[model samples]
Target: MAKSVNQATQAKAKADAVGQARALAPEVPARIGSTPATKFRGNPEIFGRLVEDHDKHRALLAMIEATAPNDPARKALFEEFVRDVHGHAAAEEQALWSTVMRNPETTEFARHAVGDHHKLDKLMADAAARDITSPGWLTHFATLKDEYLEHILEEETEQFLEAEKVLSEADQRYMRKVFERRKKAEKAAAVIEKKIALKPVA
Candidate 1:
């Protein structure tokens, strides 16, 4: 009888602890596969998504650079970087820049940003064509890195500010959703493109 009472008391204590935890937990929105909450300036949904991708790209670039030329890790990292950038740029153009282009105040900014994406794409292609062990490939990659850094800086600072002025909070939220969906499609397309590129010429 004593052992039964002790078990009951322990069960009650465990239930109370769970209740306390639930009470203390912060309320979060119920969304499927949600990214981290935005801590950056501007609309949480819009800039937040872009910032997350930017952070990822930055880390990948650093990791790729740290690897030795001709190393398998370097090759793998570069391939991943190319796919990520391709998907991100295409999706950004479709989701964010397209909306920014609609406003006269932001049209020029969007155009310039899109142009930067094109330049980076070309640089990436040039680097990919070179022998991975050769100095030329590293040089081309370094240039691409420098240019990409500059482009994202301008984007996060200037372009985003101009875009915010023109886009309402509701619009930003909607674009975030569109960006997420389009990015997934673009990433899949990037994979297909990579596979085609790898196929031997017959």
Candidate 2:
């Protein structure tokens, strides 16, 4: 009976973990009012927008991973992922994390979050150095995807809450405007970069 009870508990625990992870999984935005033209007016709107970006990043990473390394399309997909991830990180740093770093208590967490971006960029660089068909490239990419998902979870659960303690209502409203504006500009720049990348070398 004890053994059976232990087995049941383990199964329940696994189910809970799966559910929590799914809550973070990429999907159609449960977050409303985030249509392409929607402008974030406050902190809650900003937070929702960030979550939507996170969802899309994860979905893209999964799609890339599913494609074999030898597939011709892999490079283009990876390039898209790079643009989105890098652009999001840059804009978030400029608009959101900068404010978070202002608070003494949140400064360390903010720095760590930024450091994760550096680490991810390095991982991407390592992957780019290899033949996409090689096992080494896939290994690097898998590690990157795993770490990227963890970073997303950390930002939502830990950094955002800590930062909010230091941000005033007015600050949040101002930051929301900045975050949305910067993200739009970043996305436009990324689209241009993607087009350039797709262009054949002369």
Candidate 3:
């Protein structure tokens, strides 16, 4: 009974934190007319694709936070979140950061973004190691949420602006295609990895 009560308290605290963060976060404007085949210069559509994923992740994180510990909904949502985020980060690193890193002006930003990805990966691993019903799992997940939100904000506001200045329209268009392809591949790999991790130990 005590354990259940404690779990409920932690869940409430986490939900409250997420709520506050959402309330304070500035609205991110959608990139206008960023379609795949758009003929506009600078291929602003790549930012649109990235921002779409960011919005999805933000929603998933919020939904996951709202669920109670050990809730099946939480587990399902978390797994989906993990697959999407891991795939998105890997694809972004290969498609966007790789190009950005070639420009001296954007190189440091690329490095910093990649570093944040690693940190988030570690946080996810730590949380996955803990049973969902435990306080420790929620604690790790909370940290992950905070860090991810900050990272995306920086990428959208600072890194993307810097990258646009450095990349040509051709580069942007090419990366948009590459990001789509790589994201699909990476998400498949993530699913396979998750299955392996969950396999019963022999």
Candidate 4:
């Protein structure tokens, strides 16, 4: 009876996690706005969506630490994470950073975010160098993870919010497309990784 109850609990937990993943997964038509143009005052809907992605990254990072070294699931999760994170950063760099840099009003915020990205890049490089199963892997992930959260908060509050005032309608549309395209690329990479993971090794 105890074993049966434990099995049921585990099953339910797995189901819940799957539901959450689906909820967080990136989808097409990734415009940052759903509200009417007039109502869209600051940060836009896309910024909120990006913040949600951060939450997903946090969950994925935790899962990576929990899984054993050489575990296919862990490898798969890590691959997805790296791809998605790279895409997210690339999208922002392409669309938003330049605007912030060009406009003197938000130059300080842009500089701060760029510095944050530099630190995150270092953290990512450090994490990639070590074995996923190593004792210090979680510690490494924690440091990167904390900086990432801080970066997200600062971007949303300072840069993106200010962007709503400075960027024209055309700029917003262009950026939305850039972010959407990169998200699709991230998903494609995940699919390729999954196929490779399934192949039998000699």
Tell me how many residue pairs clash in candidate 3: 0
lDDT of 3 by residue, 1-202 (tens): 0012243443343344334334433242212112122112122356656766776677667776766776776777677778888899999999999988988888999999999887777767666666777655676678778888888888877777778788776777788899999999998899412211243221
RMSD of every prediction: 15.5, 11.9, 14.0, 13.6
**On a 0 to 100 scale, what is the lDDT of residue 72 in model 3?**
71
So what's the TM-score on candidate 1? 0.73
Ranked by lDDT, the better of candidates 2 and 3 is 3
Report the lDDT tens digits of candidate 4 across residue range 52-97. Answer: 4554565666566556665656656666676777777766666677
Q: Pick the candidate with the highest lDDT.
A: 3
TM-score of 4: 0.64
lDDT of 4 at 8: 47
Cα error of candidate 3 at position 183, Å: 0.3
Ranking by lDDT: 3, 1, 2, 4
* Model 4 per-residue lDDT at 155: 66
The collision pairs in model 4 are 32-46
Residues 158-187 of candidate 2: C-alpha lDDT, one tens digit per residue: 777677677776676677688878877886
Candidate 1: list runs displaced more than 4 Å.
1-43, 191-202
Give the distance in Å from residue 78's predicted Cα in candidate 3 to where it truly belongs.
0.6
How many clashes does each candidate structure show, in the order listed?
0, 0, 0, 1
Candidate 1, residues 1-202, lDDT tens digits: the string is 0012243443343334233222322131111122222233222466656765665566556665665675666676677678878888898999899989988888999999999987777777766776777755676678777788778778876787788788777887888888889888887788412211243221
The stretch of ten residues in a row with the least summed lDDT in candidate 1 is: 24-33
> Among these predicted structures, which one has the highest TM-score?
1
